[model samples]
Structure formats: structure tokens, C-alpha cells
Target: MATAAGFEGTLAALPEAKRELARLMLAARQPVPAHPAPRSGAGPVPPTALQARLWRRERTHPAVATGSHALRLTGPLDTRRLRDALTGVLRRHEALRTRLTGSTAGRPLLEVDEEPVLRFTEADLSGFTPQAAAARTALQITESASTVLDLESGRTSAFRLLRTAPDEHVLILASHLAVFDGWSSGVFLADLAAGYREGTGHLPPPELQFPDYAAWQHRWLDGPDGSAELACRRAVFASDPRARRAAGGFERGHLPVRLARGPVARGLELGAAEGATPFMTLLAALGVVLARREGRTAVVIGTPAAGRFAGALEGAVGQFTTVVPIRLDLTGGPTFRELLHRTRAAVADALGHQRLPVDVLFSDGTPPPYDVLFALHNYPAVPLDLPGIEVGQLPGPPARHLELYSPDPAAALACVGLVERDGEIGGTAEYNRHAAAPEDVRGLLTGIEEVLDRAHTAPASPLTPRH
Candidate 1:
């Protein structure tokens, strides 16, 4: 395995670029802007290229899908108040009330239904005697999310309640990716609580909506500054053989993996770099293993940078997700420790230019920058406790959620996703069954963890694969 056994000699043998990157990562700062993106029009705005792309894919793959937050609430629940809260949220966020329409003009448009009516269907499934309602809820989450949403009537979201016990029930809030995202889930829960507690239609005013962001994005990209940024980003990523091999090599499927979490936690706690995040450290480990497996001196991995970089859109619900491709240079034969520092620098640079739309990055499929997508899937798990009921949000990517919500299939990615498990961090890898095998994905996962464990112990180790 790669080791940092060499002291001064190894550090002295690094390339100029890598050495500079190491210096930068060691001193990088977490930049958080005080203001949010400005909003303009409140009326119907054009759908984002991402939304349009998803809408087209949904037309063909209607069975593959989004997410269902199946919450089991015990004790008493005010069904009327819950409904009112949800309706109020729908009224506030135009995304929930917006529909994708192509007939409006040559291009697609978001048709907003200001006073759209939504109701939750309740059923007493307590008849499944001796059978656990939680079991039923788990099985139905996939089916519930897979059903194609009717955008024509703006049925982008759905809610169903199954009575499991006199004091226990499952509240499933299913949504399509077109109108929702990882962050949006938390927004839904928070809004629901405010509605139920303060009463519906009584919340504060929402600053912006999905359409406003879309309009802003289009204007930015089409403008001179955006055009220059897009050109530069596109120029950086040429092409690679790894992307081809990943798409056409192995049998693809989901491999749900849970690694021992102590390494990540410890790594973060003991990290010498103050500004570098634990997630970045984890990603750097992932990049090392991937670079080794592919036998490529340079590795490219795509990851999603949330669209909520601006504070204003933080509360607005929409598909505000952006894809960021992180390219790691493993040349100059640097140690794994050096690699981590280098990876951190690369990520920071990418984030600086993340505002450049994903459309420009992968607009044309000719030169696929990356076949692997690595990300820390930090979906917020907000909890709610009302008098007698307790609520929780389920983490996703058991294949069903990723299969339905994963943004473009054109890249044909071998996704490596890290998630929090019982306080420690673990990983979940997924790929199309037609492209990769379960065992293959598992092997990759194991190798990645091995690399991570070793790095956590001593990040300066040489870049040698463990036997």
C-alpha cells in the first residue's frame, strides 16, 4: 500500500504543481457568501436544462424513480393539520405547483398552478395482522417513487397514510425528481412542521421560486461572463479511455456497502488541515483507490455541488442541483498524503467555478470527462416531535432512489456515494446492471476502503495497492 514512510526525501521529490497545491490545501479557507442569488420574475419561468432532460427521460422510463419519505408516527397525529401544512407548503413553493409543458411554445415551459389542490389518501392497513407496517412501508417506497408523476395536472408530489396500529401509522410523502432534490426533502419537513404548529398559510413569505432561478441561470450562461467560464471548464476536460471502459466493461447493478466508520471520524478529528472537510478527505481517499484501479495517472470523477450556494434559494424548493466534475492529477508519483492535499486543492478550485452550468460541461457527449461520480450523499435527516408524534426522514440510494433520481444517464457513471451510518461514515456504490456487476462494484468498494483505512493511519504512504 502507499505509505508516507519517507520523510524529507519524499516531500522534496514532489512536482511543482502538486507542491503548490499542497501548500494551498494546507491554507484553504471555507468561503461562505453573506448574500444569496438575486430573484427577478415570479411568474412562469423556463425549465432548467436539467429539468427538461429529466422530463424527457421520465417519458420513457416511467417505472424508474425518485424518493418516498416513509415516516412512522406513533401516538396521535392531526391529519387535518398535516394536510393543511402540506397545502400551505405547496402554495409557497412554485415547484410543487408547477407543471412541465412542451405545447406552450417551441421550447418547454413551467406552468405554475397558484392554488393547486392536493390531498392525502388515508388507508387503514392494520388488517395485515401480525405483519409489520414498517416492512410494508419499506417495500412500497420504491413502487411509490417509481410511478410517473402527472405534470399536466401538476401531480409532482403525493402523500399516503397507512394505519399500522391504533397509535402508529406510516406517512409516505412521495415526490418526483423533477420537482425535488436532496435539500428539498428537508425543506418539505421544516415547512410541514411550521404549517402544523403555526397553522397552514401562516408562514413567512418565500423569497424566490424554481422558475426565477432557472431564468437567472439561463441569463448567466448566455451572457458573456458565463460563456467565458463555460469555455474554460470545457477546455480543461479533454477525453479519457476509462470513461469508455466503465460504460461498456462490466455488468452494472447496486452494491449497498457499509464500511467501518471509525476511520473517517478519526481522520477528521486528527486532520492537520483546518479548512479541509472530512468529506473532502473521504473523497481524496476514493480518488486514490480509483486512480489505482483504473491504472490512470489522472482520474476524473463527477460530483454534485448543491445549487443552494446562494442563501436566497436555500428555502425555495426546486431541482437546484449542479454536477461538478473533480479531476485529480496523480502524476509525479506523489504519496497518498500528497494526493489528499492535492485532491483538496482540486475540489476547492472546482467549487470556485461550480456556478458554470452542468449543461455546458457535458453539453456534447463526445469527450466524456468522467465515468465515475463520487459524492458525500449528505441528505438532511430532520426530525419532528409534536406532542405525541415523532418523525424521521429515511436516507436514500438503496438503488431505487438513485435509479429514479440520478440525473443524466448519458454519462454512464459508476457512482461512489458516501453516507453517514450510526454516527460513522460509510459508502454505497451503484451502476447500471447493463454496465457493471454486483461483485465488481463490491470489489471497488473494498479497495476504496482499504485505501481509506491505510490513508487514515498514515496518509503519507506510498501509492501502492494493498494485496
Candidate 2:
């Protein structure tokens, strides 16, 4: 059997900062997986459409790390135990330990490492006041997110544990979108808690790894480009005025959308009925809001579809969410119930025809195909059941694939993300700094909630909100 002393060479070679963790590693005698996975999984790592787009951006701005999830955790101090838990979690999930490499084929590929290279950075904020420490905590988060996760160099995830005082700490968990998605974040927390409680070797390996999903997606998308399956795609979206592709592409007369300032975030909570499906009513409300904002009876907005259409992928952590266009018409001022009925039907069609990647669906569209995108976080509220450590989600800014848009309105969409958590529905309205004003998004967010409330009360009447 392998012993802790056997790991001393590996741990000693680590930077001096991780030396304390070295002690923890030796003392705990945490066993590695009884069945260590192969150094690399079979087949080429499937390049997800979302990753393709994000990778393109990363090639230019390697520092543009997007997903920084932090927790405002306060509890007893057990540094050694926590370090073991972190490594244990990394060892459990292949997705968390996988790296990305861009090939001349112009797509980023994945490589699963035999073991996780954990980098845990710690800071003692003992001297600073609570207020100053809070400021410094924000700076640390920014610094943690400043550098992109370079997979070719063999890294994708990072940890920042700051001790504000003896029993309190701020934990910032981060990962690049290349492999991590919003749902994957929750999965990581659940797995972290599990690995912390039980030995890493005890946990069952995932029935399906992310690479499996990637390979499946590759074969699914590699089929004929034009098929009868997508016949309904173009027809269902015919309600939009811009459905007809103009000759010579989009008209040059369109003006660039400008944000009055850099993107700012706003939050709101509106009641939702338990009977209503996750995003059906919420997205229906957004459709109504967009129509009101543009003064157009016909509106088109993009919403995310979890793409976990398969049972095998429910627990896997990866980039499986994709966006699809949903068109709604408020013509003749239909009743709220009537609008929802229409919204449900349109959304159902979108979901049914969403097999094509979002990028592929809109790559050929003129004027970028959509002006606004909505993400209803139908996320599982997985709690971190760590002993003595009260781990809660750090909800800030917003989480959405909206960043994929270009700065020009003619090319990108304004993205808004919403979630219903703990009996309250709230989230951030994120707009591009160059295309749309933050203040406009704030007003739009408020207006959206108002419409949602009105819909809940008066589903039979036209959706014209009373001031």
C-alpha cells in the first residue's frame, strides 16, 4: 500500500506556500482512488460550441476569467481538514481536474490528468477592520479572476481561502467556462462536501464523465447540416419581423447600441407558483417585458436550455447548457393567460429544435438574430453539508452565457439572468458595456418583475401593467 511518506517528494516539490498542506496530507493518510483513471480518457475531447466561442476570446484576452464563485463562509477553523477536503474533491471529479489544449484544428481539446494539481492560496486578514477586510476580499476575488485558466499548462480550477478572523473565512472558488458551467458549480460544491465527509476513494466514480458527453455531442452535431429535424426551426421563428433574411445580409443603417456606462448588476424577487415549470412563466414574463421595451408587438429573446436532456448527464459537471431563440407576439394585446399559453408553445418548439448548437443556429443570422437573452437558473439548490463549516453560495453579479455577445448591438444580445431561490426570485441584469446602458437594464429588470406580478394576479387580462 502507498504511504504518506511516499507522497513527501511530490508535496515537498510544491511551493513553500503549500508546505503546511503537505503536513496535512501526510497526517490525514487520505487514500487515493483504488482505481485511478487512465492518464487520458479515450477519443478526442469534444469541443463544445460554447467553449469554441469562449476559447476564441481567451486566445486574445488570456486574463478574462469569467466564472468566480465565492462563499461568505463563517465557522470553526480546521485548515488541515479543509485542505484535505479540497484535494479530495479535486480527485473525485474528472471534470474539475481536466485541462484544455487548443489544436491547429482550431478547437480546444481536453486531457484528463491522472491526479489533480491543487493550488490553494491563503491570506490572513487579521489586522484589518471588518470593513477594510471586506474591501480587500473584493480585491482578492478580482485578482483571482484576472488570469485565465490555461489548460495547455495543465490547470483549470483555483482556490482562495482568506481568514478574516480565527473562526471566519472567505472562500473564493473559480473555474474557467471552458469546462465549467453554472450547473457544474453546484455539482462541485456537492461533491466537495461529500469528499470532505467521506474519503475520496469511497465515493463512486461518476457513471459518465464529461468527455462522454462531448463525444456524444460531437457525433450528434457531425451529422448532416440540413435535416428534416430542423425544418421546424426556421418555421417556428417566422413570427419575428426579422425572420426574413435580408439580401446582402443585415442593413448597414443600424446603429451601434451603447451602454451609458460599464455593465452594472441589479436584483429583484417576484413570487412564483409551485405548479409552474422552472422557466416557463418566468421566461413568458420576460417576453412580455421585451415587447414593452422595444414597443414591438413581436419580440424574440434567447433563453438557455440545460441540454441535460439525458438521464446519464444529470450528475456530470461540464458545459452542456445551450441557448435557443424564443419568439413571442403581444399583438392585439392578448390576455396574460393567453400570452403564457403562446409562450409555452413557442418555447416548447424551441426546445424541441435546439439540437443544433446556439452558435451554429445564429452564426449565419443577420443583425445577430437576438437583441436580448434571458437565463432562468433552474438550478438545483445543493447545500454544502460540511461539518462545522457553514458553506453558502455567494450570489453576486450574474451567471449567464450572455458574455458570448459582441459589443456591437448589431452583433450581440443583451443578457439577463434570473433565479428563484429560498422562496424569492431574484438575479442580475447584465448588459454589455459598449452596447447597452446599465441603467436601462436596471429599469428593464424592475419592469420585468412588475409584469410578472401582474401576470400572477390577473392571468386573464391583457398584460398591460398598471403604473
TM-score of every model? 0.84, 0.76
Which residue pairs collide in model 2, if any?
257-435, 259-436, 259-437
**Cα lDDT of model 1 by residue, 1-467, tens digit:** 54545533554577754553343332223222223344432334567777777667667666344556677787788888888888888888888888877643477767688685785788876777746655676666655766567555577888888777787777777787777887887887788888888887576657867776776666566656667878888778855542553444333366667766666566565444635676776676677777777777887777877767777788888877777878888787677668767878999888877666575566775535666677777766666645668765554335443333234453455677777766766667777666566776676666666766776687666775334
1-467 per-residue lDDT for model 2 (tens digits): 76756666666688754664454334334332212122222434656666666766666667454578888667885777678878877776677777667556676776678777888889999689989988898888766666468656666778899998778888887787766777887787788777767756655667777766664455445444433444457565544655322233211121122211111111112222323354766666667777776677878877777777666677777777777777787788887667766777887877875555666555554443466777767778788787877766554433434554322233443566666555555556655554555566766666656666665556567765224
Model 1 earns a TM-score of: 0.84
Instruction: Estimate candidate 1's alpha-carbon lDDT, on a 0 to 1 scale.
Output: 0.67
Clashes of each: 17, 3
Q: Each candidate: what lDDT?
A: 0.67, 0.63
Superposed Cα deviation of residue 145, candidate 1 (Å): 1.9
Worst 10 residues of 1 by lDDT: 26-35
